[model samples]
Target chain A: MNAIAETVMLDSASTSVTNAVVMDCRIEKIFYGDFLAVRDSRVPIKKNKIIGFIGPSGCGKSTVLRSLNRMNDLIPIFRFEGKVTYHGQDIYDRKVDPVVVRRYIGMVFQQPNPFSMSIFDNVAFGLRLNRFKGDLSERVEQALRGAALWNEVKDKLKNSGLSLSGGQQQRLCIARAIATEPDMLLMDEPCSALDPIATRKVEELMLELKEKYTIAIVTHNMQQAMRVADTTAFFAVDISQGSRTGYLVEMGATRQIFEQPQQQLTREYVRGEFS
Target chain B: MNDSHLSAESILQAVAGDAPRNLQRAPLEIRTLKSGALTALTWVMAVLASIPLFSVIYMLLVEGGSRLDWEALTALPPSAFEAGGGFGNAIIGTLVMVGIATLISVPIGILASVYLAILDPNSKLAQTARFLAKVLTGFPSILAGVFVYATMVVTMKSYSALAGGMALAVLMLPTVILAAEQAMMMVPKKMKDAAFGMGCTRTQVIWNVVLPTGMPGILTGVMLAVAGAAGESAPLLFTALFSNYYLSSLTEPTASLSILIFNFSGMPYDNQIELAWAASLVLVLIVLVLNVVARFVGRQKF
Candidate 1:
């Protein structure tokens, strides 16, 4: 094992008794009907830390992030040959229900997909779906505050969720995800469509959210990884005889990955030499 | 002459002065003539298409206007050779039978469409069902009447409102299914993704998100089906036959506006012919009101 893997394994072992590893991906290969999409990937996600997955387009970072919550199961042709575990239990086990798994691990997509519903209803969607017993208004308020969207939307709670600006819609989606109080959150290029100011706001929200919930984000923006991520995993594409496959190249502390990458590909990627 | 040295305003003034004092407009090119001809042809085609509908309405209004009154709206029809009666019972019967048909067809049609668009889309069974539905839309209304005549009327041993309603329901099923399926298909796929990502089960996603978003469209389809069912006379002729009294039960013979219009228009009596014209006008008005209400309801926010 390399030094980064060794360090991650040590951390995993040290925190095993406490079950601090929120998710562990031991993905050997992912296939879309016999076409390889990702291969030979192993990543350990710790609790209450923001981990960034950075790579060029078509490197399978989003695919890998989606698999953590079993969102890829929706695709008819998608099949993966490895295990993804949540809190020491293999989520791919036959008895494990994906709906239940998703309840504990929420996701924010690339586009700001707010439902065609009232603002309050959007924030309260997951809570209502999971049959939350607490005061619904209070829980919605708490979630909105958690996402730093409370003040902006407090007066327009009854307005359509689609009526908000794109940035506010994304924040409402964040509020909706966190309202379920999931143990971990997965974000797939959450800020790619936002303006710079909105992107900064979302990045700041991610930093604040990491103090409570574990986060794994896929981003094409290297600077975004540098700013918000505590640890960064760099994925690279491998092309041989026309078929391109993606695999994890290196992962370590953000400073180490950006300032002193251990692998040649990582060095080249961070130096902007080549993707 | 020194165009390069002149400012833009001076050049514009000079060119304007040098331009022809009485400039003639350009003649129409062959392309413009062809396009204008095509536009006029389309307008003519549109008017020709509407001629039958407008003429029918105009004939109904002109011939029936003199006889239409409160008495005609509230009284039963007179005997073939006699006069001084109305088609009130037929109006009530039409409403009741169409209401029954709506209740029967809307649920089954909407459910089948849900299955086609959401549950098993692209499956061989779904494709076959959709193909058969499209074929059924083109199936003759007289064949629908014959179907009810064979199955329900023969089994019941009598012409009754129930049999008539069943026939109309059969005629309406394909339209409701096709329209509702289209509306359900238009529900954005991203909405489903968002729902699933929030930990909702498939059933919940369909019930809470899909159905509500598609409800207005489905309702509009249902209204259209109801209007179409109201205008069908062949099925009612085979099943309900005719009754001069108001509908008392589903198993009883019932009178409807279209059947009244059909039976009366062929008679030699002038009074019955006038009554037929009024009934035709009332039927057209009913259909017009239904379509207008559908548009109004469809415009409401879901």
Candidate 2:
């Protein structure tokens, strides 16, 4: 009777675990040294949803994005009170490894930080770091293809990543991030430094990627958020005692947030009535 | 009244036209003062630095001319002042000592530089080690020689080639450490960060990206250390103990050009004095050659 009960429990546990939420961050506060940066945030990230965080400058939208992958942990003085979970497991648990968390959630920085290495090597970097000893060339090609940069740089794999134009470098960075086959991607104003054409390319790429992986993007461009994000959250800046804090004003389906914002401030900001 | 207003309008337009052109002119006094001061300072600094260098070279070439014969190049160091001889043994011994010293110092210096440059800049141990390296760099050369003498020579009961080489190594270490560190520091941080972002471990980033990028600087540093090691006499004086004969084994004492210079400079004989000058000239020329070689190797347009 005990053996039969154990088998039944195992079957149910495995099925629920398969449908687990990818990321959940409940952050009460983010402090840099003694100054608060962001506050009172709770976000549940479902698989393959493109979530957008949009706000004005100094709003801590990027701060919240970085915290999801523990990228802000690199700063020596960065401190936060938060519970960030990945795949139903607490990511900040004492026994958890940061490297493993990063492996699952790749990030593209605002500036195009392509490796000084060749374009091919830049794409291959993440895969090699994870010790994926498969056909490196094929994987690099696939990543480049996914980023929509293969046609421009396919013939010049040996060329330096820095040799590319600004838009190309950004695409190369995207390719590098995706090369590791991460389950989720974080982009911090990825298209802000790009031209209109490049911005459209990146937007389209984000839309395409939502079919495979969950994505969270922090953007100041409200139009961009409207175009690509399925779910949209507005971050509002509040400062006290020279310390800045950002709180989420409202979050809902993108169409509803833009068309029928419930918050008066969100409506004003979205309608260009207030900065 | 209408005619007067039209006249005033034409006059105002003429003044406005000239105003922009007049405003474009540079202030003459400021430009003249800057050029004059720059010229005066350049000449003053150039002349001040050239005087000492000119005098030393003039003295070496004039006093040492007669003694720098082919015989001096071939003959061995004489045990007595009456017997005229050359610095062949000293030259060969100097070469051997410097070679061994280079062998010991270069690897350690380059590795330490790699650690300082490519490793965790945030690590407390690395920071403390850098501070210690700086302190060691300020330690006196004579002190280094004495330390080596007390440790290697006195304890071993004799000054061997090994002890001399060790003293030279000690003298070269600080220079090598500082130079190598600076060279490594010149490598751009972007390169290292890019390598890290790719998933390369700390060691891989250093070996593959950082070291190669900083290679030219490392070469220049090692060469500077080698050039410095060539003229060092104080550290080797008590440590290596000087020999008038050729050296073949690590256990035997070795004579170097600096020792030869010290001994010959004190002799009353005119030939010995000339020999000292000739030896000095040769050592300077060797140093010049090494620096030229280093510069040649390190020169990169980019």
lDDT of 2 by residue, B125-209 (tens): 7788778877986777788789988998889989887888888887677678777777778767655544544445567777766
lDDT of 1 by residue, B1-302 (tens): 46664666466678886534555654487877888899999999999999999999899999998999998999999996676999999999998889888889999999999999998899999999999999999988988889999999999999999998899999999999998999899988878888889888989988888887887788788888888899999888888888988778889899999999999999999999999999989988988888787777666352
Per-model DockQ against the true two-chain complex: 0.50, 0.17
**Cα error, candidate 2, residue A116 (Å):** 3.6
Highest-scoring model, TM-score: 1
Off by over 4 Å in 2: A1-20, A150-159, A195-201, A208-212, A240-242, A273-275, B1-30, B43-135, B176-220, B244-247, B261-302
Native interface contacts retained, candidate 1: 0.55
Query: Would you give me the overall lDDT of model 2?
Result: 0.80
Residue B22 lDDT, candidate 2, scale 0-100: 50
**TM-score of each model, in listed order:** 0.88, 0.77
